[model samples]
Target: MTPSPATAAVRVRRAELSDLDDLVALEQATFDHDLVSRAQFRRHLDSDSARVLVASANHRRFLGTALVFFRKGSRVARLYSIASLPEARGKGVGTALIEAAEAAARQRRCQSLRLEVRIDNESAIRLYERLGYRRIGPVEKGFYEDGSDAFRYAKTLA
Candidate 1:
């Protein structure tokens, strides 16, 4: 059953080491190849500049997640990943996770937020546009090792 917005029971919070399995599963389900390894995820979890946020329902069911990395000298944060379970799409979980990431970036005094979306990912592009992100440029093919073109987007927070 889908959870309502008021009682969605979905909470967005920092991912702990124990959440590695669920985070990896969600990443694999959302992307093609290039799935992040457990070791990579653990490293991010332990890093001060990287963050992984998870959205969970009923405090147990993982619904979605977003990964962000902040560059120390540039004051620019990159949104590395944002994905929601297929069944959980359109439930506002992705939005919540993104807003959380924005808050986190702002907390770190980031001046802008950036991300790259696959050229064919219309839904994600629309979501980012609606959230005030604008396309900055396009990266050539083979950017993802899957030959998918990527569109870069950025939003100035400061």
Candidate 2:
């Protein structure tokens, strides 16, 4: 089934404490390795260097989440994590989240956005490539808790 027009109208916004439960559930549902704990999420939610963006439908229900990290005195920002419900995949939700992350990074005066993805995730790699991110260098060994390697990618913001 396809999403309704209303469901397709996803709003990306800064996440609040109220969305903690949904964010935790999303993390569990989306990854098998390198999971972010609730405590870590809480810390990021409160951290000045990190920004959490949530994609919501009807401004009430969260469909996806993305986290971006910025470093002081650095021009590069990291797209730390992003995930959408299986039902929301292929519906432009992930793209929306990425665009939001880039915007957030730009707002913070970042010159580029970077992210690391499992080397085996071809679909995600394609998505990143389609969005103008390119591989920065050789894949890193043991990048995840399960020892999966990852490819680092980066995009320069206009």
Candidate 3:
């Protein structure tokens, strides 16, 4: 039986090595031709400065994942990727993962959280804007594989 949203238990926590496969699968499902390989996922899992969070429902199925990197000198946190499984979209998994990342940034004394979203992803753009992120600039041809431009958004916590 499929788990219903009402009964689904969504947990957002720090991702471990064991979650790499699910993360990669979700990445592949979320983005076209921009999926991170297993090697890259392992590297991120081993990195100290990288914060990866995963959301799961019913303690079994992976719902979504978010990856963020911390910058030392500038104390800025950059959100590298935030992807949710097709079944988890619009179900608050992405928002929960993002919130967890922001909390981590706050704990690390990061001044702000910044991320780039493809200009054509209207739903994601709307979500970020609603979450208090302000677009500062555009990354010209930032997404090479698909030749899509990216819009940079930042949310200052301090």
Which model scores highest in TM-score?
A: 2
Candidate 2 is scored at a TM of 0.92
Worst 10 residues of 1 by lDDT: 1-10
Separate clash counts for every candidate: 0, 0, 0
By the TM-score metric, which is better: model 1 or model 3?
1
lDDT of 2 by residue, 1-158 (tens): 23335335777889899999999999999999888889988999989899999997654588999999999999999998999999888877888888889888988999999999999999899999988999999989999999999999999998
Cα lDDT for residue 105, candidate 1: 92
Which ranges of candidate 1 are over 4 A from the true structure? 1-9, 58-60
Evaluation by TM-score, superior candidate among 1 and 2:
2
Clashing pairs in 2: none
Ranking by TM-score: 2, 1, 3
TM-score of each: 0.89, 0.92, 0.88
Q: Rank candidates, lDDT, best first.
A: 2, 1, 3
lDDT of 3 at 92: 76
lDDT per residue as tens, model 3, 7-54: 246677888988977887777767786677888889888787888888
